[model samples]
Target chain A: MSAALDAAPGRELPVLAVVGVGLIGGSFAAALRRAGKVGKVIGAGRSRDALVRAKGLGLIDEAVALEDAARQADIIVLATPVGAIPAILSRLLPFLKPDALLTDVGSTKADVVKAARSALGDRSECFVPGHPIAGAEKTGPEAASADLFVGRTVVLTPLEENTEQCRTLAIDLWKACGARVVLMEPDAHDAALASVSHVPHFLASVFMAQVSGADDADLRLSLAGSGFRDFTRISAGSAEMWQDIFMANRDAVLQELKAFRALLEQTESALAQGDARELHELLERAAVARRFWGSRSGHE
Target chain B: MSAALDAAPGRELPVLAVVGVGLIGGSFAAALRRAGKVGKVIGAGRSRDALVRAKGLGLIDEAVALEDAARQADIIVLATPVGAIPAILSRLLPFLKPDALLTDVGSTKADVVKAARSALGDRSECFVPGHPIAGAEKTGPEAASADLFVGRTVVLTPLEENTEQCRTLAIDLWKACGARVVLMEPDAHDAALASVSHVPHFLASVFMAQVSGADDADLRLSLAGSGFRDFTRISAGSAEMWQDIFMANRDAVLQELKAFRALLEQTESALAQGDARELHELLERAAVARRFWGSRSGHE
Candidate 1:
């Protein structure tokens, strides 16, 4: 933290550059800007149109090349899709300032941790793996909001190689964005996320597939109401983004899916056998459990 | 429609009786009362406390014994748990008036249809089986709303024994409550609802079971957000009610569950094999299909 402060000299605001200025990245920049903690935000992306749009929306102070942003950044935040993080890190490595720190807001952490090890080599100590568990059905800079991360959980899986100062600085940055930061091992983060996020996305998508594949799909869809709407909301997310998350966290997601399948099979067998008592117990248990969790999470 | 009109005799409001005036039944009574289509609403339930509460809340005009309510009724609406419908219908048979029409708001149609056939015998011609596709997280008479069925689908699966007059009366009743009436065979209603509602309920329950069964459930749940909240909302439904629904619609629910499991297996295999394009295509298909359906359903 002191080293970062030393590099910034007399400036009160830190120089921040956000790579892949989409929803997450743009929101982070906007939040930091609103907090008056960022000196200048340079947006980096493959699309000139998006970068231009982001700047036009005041989500970024300037739009520049990825390497150029990296060279001048005091803190670099990668907000690209999970699959694009590795290559972007590789590209930013050469131009990365000596005192600059790197963090990401990707959905998965273990993959990012591995990518950092391979791409940063000796500079791996400057990188912190993080994921802000916040998103909407829509994406892109236009959908970004300064308050998106407020009251949300941001999990950080810092590498053992990362310096104490680097980790502290990354945590401080997420805090400044109005997020609650929690620390966990990369594997633990992946497993937990597999249960909470990845599996739900896949389940919703599968349910959608089942309904749409039906012979009277249009008729069935016509009868679907609020319950179906909420249940399938996340399935409407971008395929490119979700596919990357699915591919990156394959092992953890597979384990969760297997567990879910076992539960579903149990329910199926109970229903098939006309075991009303057993079915009742299973549903009661789940309903009670969900209510408890919802109350604890303030959702109920 | 003529028979019902003939029975009414004059310009008098119809004498209505509501059996098991919980959420659905109570809502129907309230809506009809609001529309001035109903005269005296006699509430009947096993729970005396519930009946008293319904009367107090104006969900019913008075509380009475089931037999008494059935004797004086011009129309009867059974709004009980699916498992309880059969016995309730049996109990109402001896006390039923010759011109009294019968309807129900059970979640499963086939089971109720079978129950009506067995219970009413020759008088099954006057019994109509219907389901209002509306609900809330809460239950009981206190949760009843006059507009609960407004703009919602009320599916009627009339038995072959049902006279045209009986069917018309039930349709008119639902329409008076602001519901859009759709006629289908009992089996079709069960199958369609199994696809759109029952399976989603169980899937959400099973998903909740999987997550809550984890060793670090508290941690995982804390990390869950709006997506998980919406996906699992149906899982928080009343256990007694859903269990009965699952049991009553067992065959149809099982078929939908099997279909869902097959779709899930496809997604799992794609994820396991690291087939990014396959996963993307699957997700893309689900996304596009959901969007199309959502647009048509006016939910987007």
Candidate 2:
């Protein structure tokens, strides 16, 4: 309902189990704890060492097995790679508490939505497919921060079978963690994210590949300034993580990439034709749009 | 010559006239004045109000007519747009004193070299073409910083006819302003710059165009974060300036753009085919290259 209507105000809140206690999951645990919105946080992952580290860092109150945590957790937060989400959801389903509120922080929504539909079945109303549009190049539990999602957007893709109370509980939890929550259809979430996130990452990688593919790449890099640094910065992110994202959001990403390629071809044609006015007009439109967007996003 | 081979030291240096006192030109005047390497710095531009403002900010010791300043200046720095450089050279040729050394701050090299060859003729020995790989989204005299080129690379493309003394003078001046000068052939400079700088600008603009082309662009932009901010930052730069750069280095930029397009196609196909391994490998190569380049360039 409202921000004043806390997820569980004036009561000992539910235990929130964060599976795959890395950046996203760890940050969720830390932020919830920092906000005094949870009674306990459990870390579940394949790596015992990482889970122990997360516990030591107070990102989680304790490290536990996923099945054990799923049986006891009042809420289950699946924060893993997109490709890994479906498998993890299947595993958690058998042990999950009937009243548990399940949510995931994945870049792609469609695949996760499908996973919830297949795995949760009659209990799908408790599962919410979500994506928090916030992260840094560096990852892991050690890199997690309580304010990672503050002032950031978190999109929730609720299924038609989801109960209104389940949806409101998810939103209130995210709000308590200091994020601005927005609702969208699964396909809509994927498309919007493809434009703003997935496609941009691919473009950065493509541009980086072009420069490195050159014979004198080192020489070209030597002359690179802030422009090159900022432009290709995202290309240095984890390749494995991005590969999964590309595959999970394939159709939307492909469509946006096609649009991007078309614009690039048009720009290249203008340059080849020595059409200064045409090139200027194209750049001018992009510049104006970017400026307007940046101003709205407090980037200006 | 070493940086110790000062352009002017211990004695009051000759009058330095900065034609087209905008960002590049204005910064030159400011850095030289800060180093106390000149007796007086004169501002020359078509905009008298800007010239007066430059003088008021002490970016120039005085504001003067271009022809009048050219007649008396010992060193003339052309800081105009690339498209305007040739015409400016033509105008300066008749009024240029034999001993006056001429240099320009243009982004592209080949066109400026051709202009110098055609306009200077036998006097080409006194001209040097340079490109300082330093700038910001902001422009004009007000945005000029004395340390703009400090620790930055400034490539000098001296004509074959350039005298040793003339070349040394240009290097000395740039060195005195704290720029690390690198020698390059005009064509080589353009090609290298296209890979590192020019193509990246176009790519940013193209990506921006793609995002904004969507009907729900505002919603998409609301989800845009730091990665988008950094990736498309260059797209916010002055359109008129970039248009000139794209046109001046048309052939080289087109070549780089083609390479970039091919890479994008490869990446797109990998995603379309759900070839995770191929996508991962491509991204891995790009990530490795970007990390290596970033480390060398202090971007890491």
Candidate 3:
């Protein structure tokens, strides 16, 4: 830490350029500020209104041009959806300083890493891919909070040739936001997230839609309490954002979805046969497993 | 409403007998008293400790023997788990006045109604099988709040033989708790609930368990966030309770589960084939449907 500080002749507060000031970027800025860790936070996004909102909310100290942010800041956070990362990286790569750090908050990373390796060539060493396991169904700067990442896990998938400076700084940024950082391979991160996150997103949306489909819609919505609300919350997420994740984590998302289908078939067969005993047992097992899951996830 | 009130002479303030005193029972008792809709709340449970706790929490005005409650109360609530309804009705049947109102807060009905009808014989006409579509992932008296049913749906499955007295009382009880009451056939109610409630519970449990079976348990849990938690919240529901619901709503639960399975398979095949366009279209539809659900559900 002392060596890092001493490396510069004139000590200036570290600057992190946050691109696409939506839920991830805005919250990243707030979390960094709340911890009193990073020095200067610059907000950048295609949406001038969102950047303004991010700045006014004190999520960032200043609004900086995306290109300038890439060149001047010591760290750059591309907080856009996964599909947007490749194009954004292509545009920002040339503008980035030789030693500047690049990272992303995309949910799916295998595609991001591949895109980065291809687009940035040798400079891929400066890019680190990380995802903070923190979000809500709601979006935009307003939904972002300083405590969003508190006690949440953040996974970083650095390429084999990636520099320690890039990886360590990336880890430190997440840690400063109160996240417990873990390192994993890009494919592993993508696959695990598909099972835990993206697949659930699709499942939730489909189930909610199906329930609302069968006549008496208003009555059904009225019947829906917290259980239905919670079960289907993710279905309301940014459509395009989920599309990006699905495209990126395609293989893994489908794999988990397939497994879920098999389980559903067994449940369906029991129900179709009016085999109350079998249905009861399966539901019981599911309930027990889910109880364990609820307990485990509730505390976190 | 006015006729029933004037007809029943006011002596000793008619007690509202609550048979379970778990989250649902305690919440109902609190809502009834706090809303000034009931004269007294009588709590009953097999466990003396649970009954004592419910009474101590001001969830009930008194904790008494089930027979005593059945004897003293003008309104009786079988708020216990569905499976317990049969035994409870059998034990309390001989003590219930034919004119005294009886209902329930079970999640699933038809079977509970059928079973209780057998127990009470001809007097079962007074026992209305009701299920308030309200609850939290949390359970027990400690988890109870008077506002649990506020602005939520309460489905009352009335039988063809249900007297006007029974239906009116059932609606009034739920309305007192700020619920929007709906009257449906017991079978239809069971079918609709299995699709909207029970199916979601099993899907959630299966999704979580599939990942739990993976080599990395800790990693899986760490990656799960609000989306995963919300989707699987019902998985934490009582094992025995869900078991009973599955048996009761077997036909509908199976049908919904099958539909969910077919969709899940389609999703998987799309991914396996790298058909991003197909996946995108499916997810986008869910996302749109979910947006309406979110506004209705008041989700963030």
Candidate 4:
């Protein structure tokens, strides 16, 4: 499937501009380069040092200003945090090529779509909001890999204003990175992510913070095993990025958190009442579901 | 350190019996055999098929009844689910050798210690309540590995009635399996484990149950990425074992759950109120603590 995408006959390899060349952007550039699916790659970010490092690593052909990138590149990917999306979109709108396809690697899609609509107006037709569901806790160009998106999923919430050409291009780009692309409505994407990604990240951070705040935290951490290690792995993600995500997708995340809290309360009540049957059934349902998911997803 | 323990001079290799013959028991017997630290291994469990498999795997020299194992072995390790510990202890008490050392690999220490005291009376001194801080979601003898305890922590809660010789022998047994052994009070061990392990498992199960029970569960599961995979990995654990753990360490797990709920509420309030500063600080604190722990534990 990826081979067909990578070997697109008669399709021109477009010049790619990756704004905010951190793990996500750097990895996208690296993946496309490995697949021989792009022309020159231009890196742009607030961090000059990161762009330089990305160029040195050959993930990008050159480091350029965001405006220069928007003016020259045939495709531009905004890979910055959700909070920075609006300002960056506004900055690029003036220099953006009329035919250039624009997309984002933001975690929250609805907010990014809304920001693009506000910033680009009618030009929003060129934009496709995307989220590649793959990452490590590690960040930055140094941690980026060409295989980061292999066998991962990428969700694209194409705006009604988006041109069919632009949507196709965005899907092809991720497919070339060895990712399975799924399309959903912007709100649907937000709600699904809130349940699967956003709320899980928030809960991990909350759990980690609670444990760390305890007086006997050092002891607790020492006794922590592989289970704790895996459970709180996402808590090590960048604070700024997560804060933006929670704020950007506020309603969906809040709803999911409420649902989670209700389940937690039910569990607590079961334990308090010494309801072994209830507790076991709850755990059995979860275990069966988790094992089934793991089997289907090949994650176990 | 492990080499020192593995090469204990002039110490006679004990005839070992592993009760339950599952992941924990099978692995213990396998590790001791690999280190040449055992004379023989007798496996005892409720499942005759599991015992047969364990014996075929060479994890045990023979399969025996609990009474036969207790009478024959120099060291008996109760590596069953916490809920089964009391019943197993009662059955083994009649035939337990006077000079034999006893230990357990139950997740919760205090309850196991309590059960031992009730079942064995003065003989409880020979039972060192231990928890190996290592596991995978997969259970049974087939999942057991000789290296399962390597570089892991084995926490021992030695009773005040425990003989010095019995305690040392228990510590050495774990050390021979390439584990780092630490002594902790049973209550302290329970509390720390609740914070780091038990509560995290419960939360994962609760979250999984909530998501699985959702109307759009298939969509949510499709979008679930590596973060969700790792966060819910422990939820795939045996339901019966976890139910036993939650019930056995009820107070500590409940206390930890209350603390987690409080922090979760604070986070929800911050998000609801759009208190970005508060939310950012909480996330940052967690990120810092998680990264520090990851670095120290070499888990990242």
CAPRI quality band, candidate 4: high
Model 3 CAPRI rating: medium
Order candidates by TM-score, high to low.
4, 1, 2, 3
Model 3: per-residue Cα lDDT over A22-109, one tens digit each = 8888888888767655678888878999989888888888897778888777778898877877788888887887778788988888
The model with the greater lDDT, 1 or 4, is: 4
**1 or 4: which has the higher TM-score?**
4
Go through the candidates in order and give each one's DockQ. 0.72, 0.77, 0.57, 0.84
Query: Candidate 1, which segments miss by more than 4 Å at Cα?
Result: A1-10, B1-10
**Strongest candidate by TM-score:** 4
Q: How close is each model in CA RMSD to the real structure?
A: 2.2, 2.8, 3.0, 3.3
Model 2's CAPRI class? medium
Each candidate's lDDT (Cα)? 0.86, 0.85, 0.78, 0.90
- Model 1 is docked with a DockQ of 0.72
Model 2: lDDT of residue B233: 94
Error of 4 at B7 (Å): 11
**lDDT, candidate 2, A185-283, per-residue tens:** 999989998998888899899889888988898789899988999899999999988998888889999998888778778778778878878888889
Candidate 2 chain A minimal-lDDT segment of 10 residues? A1-10
Q: By lDDT, who's the top model here?
A: 4
Give lDDT tens digits, candidate 3, residues B1-300. Answer: 322232344534457888988888888888877866678788887878889988888888888888888787778888777888888888888787547788888888888788877888887887888887776587789989889888877888877777887778778878989988888888778777777788777777667666666788667767788888778777767767777777777777777777766666676677677787786777777777767766656654
- Tell me how many clashing residue pairs each candidate has: 0, 0, 0, 0
Ranking by lDDT: 4, 1, 2, 3
Candidate 2: C-alpha RMSD after superposition: 2.8
